[model samples]
Every structure is written in structure tokens, then in C-alpha cells.
Target: MTCGYARAVERARAGSARVPLTRASAALRRWSQRSQVTLTAVLLLVAGLLTVGIAADPDWVPPATFLLLEVVAVFLLRLRPLAVLGGTVLVCAWGLWWWGAESITPGFLAVLTLSVVAIGVFARERQRLGLRGAPGDRMLVDLRDRLAAHGRVPPLPAGWRVDSEIRSAHAEGFSGDFMVAGTRAGGTTLEIVLVDVSGKGMGAGVRSLQLSGAFGGLLGALPREEFLGAANGYLLAQAWAEGFATAIHVVVDLRTGDFTVSSAGHPPAMQLHAGSGRMELLDTVGAPALGVVADLRCAALTGRLDQGDVLLLYTDGLIEARGGDLEQGIDRLMGAADRVLAPGRGSAAAVLAGVRAGDDDDRAVVLIQRA
Candidate 1:
């Protein structure tokens, strides 16, 4: 008890020590943002002066080098987009008027014009996003990283191998498909929830992060059967017009190879039997797609994995095709999976990479193997 108390006190002290550091970091970020406009103005002024110097002495440095100022303006945009854009225009116009036919040759003018157009495009994109700099993109990256943190499978005892992977539509940095996992009873029970948020790619990114965090907590805190109902409740509370989702919640007993699975309007998971090298669907049905209906009628599906058996969980994005049936998509996927998850080749990542369907949406897969 003394040791526990001592450790708790140490953690409290360490946490307290970080307060000042957090405040300092936040203050520093505010200062940087507040100074961006001034910094961009200064940079533009310097670029203008440098351009004048280089243009006046064309012999020292080629007047064509003045085009480099436009490139500099692009970098300055992260500091302040509209200001940098207006300043770049003024500087370029003044230089063209001051030097005219001599240093501001047609070739130089052409390159500068193209660079300015590119900068304008970038500025418009930033404006559309209502973002002044790279912070928005960085925030998305951080959230994606956090979601990945929750998906990490806990270290289990020998004879159990579990792995997962996801791909966003159009090669985005984040996806609507994500997984959150938890372990109970000293890592003997592994629980995984694979969710596919409505929409795809970056369009569904924010919702994915929000629900992943909510479900991650629920998975760790709630009973295996209570997870979907609670997740549905959480989503319903959000009241987003399009906040519907489909999820598969699974719990695996590492020691006995016994598993229980359930889904909320999600595609079925598949099992690869080690004996006959056959893949069979779990065919478990539950409530309607999450957030769609208030009344949920979820039923638990139970099964056991013999030695060398493999269970595969995936998002619809992996098998779905435009203007095609869902079951057909599953058939094609299983055929490909059978070959990929065959006795010699036991890699879920390989199966995901090999199957070439559902490119229009995000795809994710989790494989549990009893070795």
C-alpha cells in the first residue's frame, strides 16, 4: 500500500510539473499565430527589396532569378495567405513597371505569372478550408494517429496472432474505416470493434475520429454484448443528420479459442477452417445500421477456432462495387481471401492488398489467427 501510494504521488508530481510546460507551449503557439501577419509582411518587403537589387544589377544576377520571389511567396502563404498574395501581386507589378522591357522579359514574366497562379490556387484552397496555415492538416494527422493508437492489438500469449490494416479512399491520410480494441482479464480476453462510418475519405474523417474515441472508451468499459447498444446510444445523441455507421464487435478468448461476434447492420465476418481449407461467413445479424433506428435487437453469435483457424473481419469498402450486389461482392472477396489466406499464405494484409474491389470507399480488415 505504501509503494502504491508513493507511485501515485510521483505520478501526480510529474503531472503537475507538466502544467507549466503545457501553458508555455500554448502561449508559444498563440504568439506564433499572432505574429504571422507581421512576419508575412516583412518577408514580402524583403523579397521586394531583393528583387529590386537583383533587377537593377542584371549583370550580377540574372533578372530571371526574380521569378524565385513567387516561390518564396508560396511559402509565406502558410503564414498569411491573402496578405502574402496581395503583397506578391503589388511587388511583381511594381517590378514589371519599373524595369519593363529590360529586366522583366517575356520569359521572366511568363514564369512569374504561372507561379502567381499556383500561389493563388493554394490561397483559395486555404480560404475554402477556413485555415490560415498547415494546422488543420496537422490536426487531422494527429487525430488519425490517435485512432491508430486505439487500434493497436494488445500483446497476447503464444498461439494467437492478430493484425489489422486500413486504406482510405483516394489515398487520403485518414479514412472512415477504423478499429478500436481492448483486453480484459489479464489479456486473456481480446475485444475488437471495427466500425465503418458513413461517407468515405476525408469527408468522413471528423466523424471517424469522434466515434473512434467514443467507441474506444466503450469497448474498454462496457460488456461485450452491451457495446453496440451503447455505441448506438452515443451516436444517436450526436444527432448528426448523416452520423449513421455499421460496426462489428468481437471478443475472443485466447486460451480456449472461443469467440463471440455481433454486428450493427455491418457486413458479416468470415472464418477460414484449417481442416478443409474452406472459408465460411459468420452470417450474424443484429440491429439496423447504427444511428438509424432507436430500437436495437442485437443477438450474439458464438463460435470456436480450432488450431490454425483464422477469422477475418472487414469493412464493406473492401467488397462493395458500384451497381453490384453486396453478396456477390462478398463472394469475390472470399474467393480471393481463400487463395490468400490458404495454408502457406497466412497474411491478412496480403489479402487486403490482393483483393481489388471497393476503390471508391475506405477499406479495413482485421485477421485473428489461432496458430
Candidate 2:
């Protein structure tokens, strides 16, 4: 009797060991078990109904064999994807062959079509979610590249003095309204460009970043005329250059206070008189935008920016912002510059904060004040 009890105990342990489930594995095991149970119940119900219907038919093949084959096919469902696909295809082929010898029910056709569609759809979704190179994946990768370049540049000029700050209403993305990079070259020449890429979101944002990089590099290297020419040439060469970005390129002389500006499809930047708070829109007459043509000449016009005067470079997003009067917006911007830029303090923050408060679209401001 003891020997018999030992054998029985061994058998019970073997059965329990077959399903080696631990607490950590319990959820997955339960889910799989439930699925198996539900499938088994469904198969049994289907087989039982088929068996009952076939029992009365004198000319039909044996229901037992058909049910056996179905049970075997059901067991193959847990195989790897390719194997499952092969087995399903084979089963479908067999069903088609059987249809030639037997009556094909509407239910069988419906189930077969549903199974194939479900498998295809589910497989596609899983593959897309798992892989690293779908259209969405490419866009995500492009987005990362775009964001990585945002406001990323070498710090303020080395030999030249500078003041700069960035404030964003939305942190993750920019709406294409951003400032110009101005470098004081020698005693008189000052290089600056106010850039606005065509649209918003990752696509336009990426192009804006590229445009800035190209423009900045050219700003530091080429002469005023050559730089403008090369910039337009490069823009027009872009594969998707859609005549989009609008910009203003300016070179100012600190000694003589003489400034030269050229615009291409961009909103004219404003000049603010330091004491009187007068605002004037710089010249807008120039060639078509950079990407629109390769050989267009940008007319350069010169003016004087005296001491205690401020040059305000702005984008269309600010001037075109609706829900408020445009003139009032300009007045508010000018007023804030005068207020926040108290006697000793340069009011750059007041300018940016004022724009942030009033304007709706993306706003970028570059304030040039000779201290």
C-alpha cells in the first residue's frame, strides 16, 4: 500500500509540474488558459452541432473524422505566425476541395473569410507596432532630428558682445516664428536675417531649422551680396522648396549707423525711435522669395540707426495675429520696450513678454540696441 501511494504521489506531482506557473507568471498563464478554454468550448459546440446534424444524413462522410481534423487544426493555432499561416492556408485549401464533393454552408464561408481577414489585419498591426521603419517611424525620427537642432548653436559671439534669450509658449514645437542672427563684423558692418519658414509642425519645423543653419553659416562667411545670393540659390535647390520661407537680410553699420536691408516675401521689420517711440516698417520691395527663383536679385537699401535707437525684427505671425487690432499690437510692443528697458536695464524681456501676452501666433523678437 505504501508503494502504491508513492506512485500516485509521483503522478500527481508530474501533472502539477506540467503547468509550471508561478505568481509572476500567473497573469499570462491565466490569460492563455482562458483563451484555450474558450476556444475548446467553441470547437466542442461546433463539433457537437455538426455531429448531430450529420447523424441523420445517410450520404455524408463520418462526422468523427471531420471533427478530428478540425480539432487538429485548432491545436495548430498556437504555432508561430508562419506556421499558423501555412496551416490555415492548407486548411482553407482542404475546405475548398471538400466543397467540390459536399455542400458548402454559408456559415463556413463567413468564418473562413473572417479568419483570414482577422489574421491579416492583426498581423499587419503587430508588425507595424513592432518594427522600426514605418512612415510614422520615419516621421518620428525626423521629429527627433528637428527638435535636437532647436535653438542649438554655439554660445554668444566670442570677440563681439551680445545679448539673447528664448521664450516659448509651446515647449515641444515651434510655430516657425523666430529671430535673425546678427553678428557685428568689424567696426561698421552688422549682419542679420529674420527668418520665417512656411508652416508649423514637424515638416515645416525641420525645414526651418535647416534654413536657419544654412543662413547662419552664410551670415558668418560670405559678403552681404554674395550671402544673399548663395542663400537664395541654396533654398531654390531644395527638393521640396515650395517658395515658402519669407525672410529679411540686413547689414548695419555701427559707426555711421547706416543699415542696408533686403526683403523676400517677409513682413517688414520695424524701427523704433528710442526717445519718441516712433515705429516705421522697413522697405518691403525686393525680389521674390528665396526658393521661388534661383537668379533673382535682392535690392539692398541703406538707412541710419542713430544712438538710443532700437531695431525691431519681427515675423508675420506677430503682425498677422488676429483677435486684436494690428496697430494696437505694434503700439503695445513699442510701449513695452520703453517700459521694461528702464534707464540702466535693456528691455529685451519686456519686448518678448509683451509679444507673448498680446499676439496669438508664434512670436519672435530681435531687439538691437546700441549701448
Candidate 3:
């Protein structure tokens, strides 16, 4: 008992000695997170104000100085950009009234007007969307990278490569089309889901981001037969206004060159057999898109990829157009694939670039080539 108590006392002393350092480190981290950006903005404003106030001629200071500071503050103090904007405007207006009351300074007035607009937009975002900016942007960066990284199929055994690409509508930063892939069973099995969320570009960015993360987690969690059902259930639960989405699920056995595919109202997946050099559809027709119906059971289609064969999965944006039908788009894509890929050296990005149909919409293409 004495030895145990002595040992406990010694351990307590050790932990107590480290507590101060741990707390100091945490305090430093918190300060750095907010201090760096905030400090930089404040220092910039102070320097600008000092430079203008001490100038031999006020005119030489430039009336646009505060405006530049306001703009910089909006990005720097994005956590409360409007506050920074308001403060800047008030300071500028006050200075104009006190120092140049008789002067008609259109520049400061213009800055004030622009600040009001920024404030209004930020107000709308807060009241309607309840979204706020924070240092959590680091978290968002990680998530965005996760969404892109998951699309890269895990390193395949020799002689196999999966090439994928995604482009947002209007060439924006986000797209409705995304894919999540994983390998299981000693890296011999590869599973993937190519999803097209309801909207396009940044309009569907949030949905795409959310679904990509969820689908990535579910990629190898459930049995192959239950993967789609689970994803369908998840979407239905979201119950969003424009919740329905189309997806193609594929599972391949790398060793055997066998794969099973299923669709959720998505465009058909195309396969090119090296032996025939013909592209064929591998779609389970008549299945409903995700979140369209509950307890949906989609039919699966099976296929094989021989040596030098390729499989293509893509979003509707790559094909759908005004007054265009499904088969029409497929036929056009087949012809393009034959011409571009017939050389046996084409890539997914090449196929995406060669196709001219989806210029007005977001486009994504994934090519699984078995070399």
C-alpha cells in the first residue's frame, strides 16, 4: 500500500509538472489561429491611417486607402467580415466629416456604398443560410482534398490503371459529379461509386461534398449487394427539396477481370472489349435514381474486362443536352471513343477533352483500363 501510494504521488507530480507547458502550448495555438490574420489586418489599417494622417498633403495619401483596407479585411477577417467592413466605413466617414466637411469626396462615398453592399450580402447569408466563416476553412480544405483523393483508385496490381477526371459547370471550382473508390479483400477487389448530385457547379457543391464523404465511408463497409440500398437509404433520409441523384456502382475483381455493375437512374456505363473493339452498355435499366423511391432494389449487370479493355463511367452532364435523347448521346460517345481510344493509348482526360457535347454543363469521366 505504501509503495502504491508513493508511486501514485510520483506520477501525480510528473503530470502536474507538464500541465503548465501543455496549457501554454494550447494558448499559443489559439492565439496563432486568430492572431496572425487579425493582427496583420489591424496593422495594415493602422499603418495606412498613420501614413495618411502624417502626410505633407492629405491628397497625396489617396482617398482609396481605406477602401483597399476594407477589401483586405473582408478576406482576412472573414470570420466577421461585415464587422471589419462596418468599422472601416465608419472610420472613413467620420474622418471625412471632421477633416474635409466642405470637400465633396466621392471616393469615400463610393467606398461606403460598396461596404453597404458587402454587409447586405453577408447579412443575407447569415439570416437565410446561417453560415459563418471561421478558421475551419482548414477543415474544408481537407474535405475538398479528401473528395478528390478518394476518386483516385487505390494502386492496382500491375497491368491495371484507373484514370478519372471531373470538371464543374462553367469551369467553376466544384462539380455535381464525383466518385469514391476503395479496395478490399487483400487489394484484389475494387469498388467504386460515380455519383451526380442534383445540381451543377457550386449549386451542387455542398451536396456533392456531403455525399462524397458519406459514400467514401460506405464504400467497403457493407456487402456488395447492400451498397446501393444503404446509399439510397441515406439520401432518402436527407429529404432535401431536390434530393434525388443518379449513380453507377461498380465492383471489380482485379485478378479475374470480372466486374458487376448497377445503376440508379444514371447513364449507362460503357465497356470496350479488346477482342471486338466494340463499346457496349452495362446498365441495369428500370432502376430508380437515389432518393426517388424507398426500399428500391436495383438489378445488377455482370461483365468482364479482358486484356487491353477499358470501362467508362461518367455523369449525365457529359452527354445530356437540349432535345437530346439517351441513345443519341451514347452513340456519339461510342464513335468518339472508337476514334480516340482505338489507338490504345488514350486517357480519361483525353476522352473528356475530345467530347464536345457537355460544354455547357459539368462533365466527369472515369476510365478503368486493364493493361
Per-model TM values vs. the true structure: 0.81, 0.53, 0.81
Ranked by lDDT, the better of candidates 1 and 2 is 1
Best candidate, lDDT = 1
Question: Per-prediction RMSD in angstroms?
Answer: 6.5, 21.0, 9.8
Clashing pairs in 1: none
Q: With candidate 1 superimposed using the best TM-score fit, by how many Å does residue 181's alpha carbon deviate from the native? A: 0.8
Segments in model 2 whose C-alpha atoms lie over 4 Å from true places:
1-171, 179-188, 241-243, 275-277, 323-346, 356-360
Provide the overall lDDT of each model, using Cα atoms, as 2-decimal numbers: 0.75, 0.54, 0.72
Best by TM-score: 3
> Which lDDT value does model 1 have at 74?
49
- Which of the two, 2 or 3, has more TM-score? 3
Backbone clashes in candidate 3 total 0
TM-score of decoy 1: 0.81
> Across residues 322-351, which tens digit of lDDT does each residue of candidate 2 receive?
677766766666566556653425655566
Report lDDT (Cα) of residue 289, candidate 3.
95
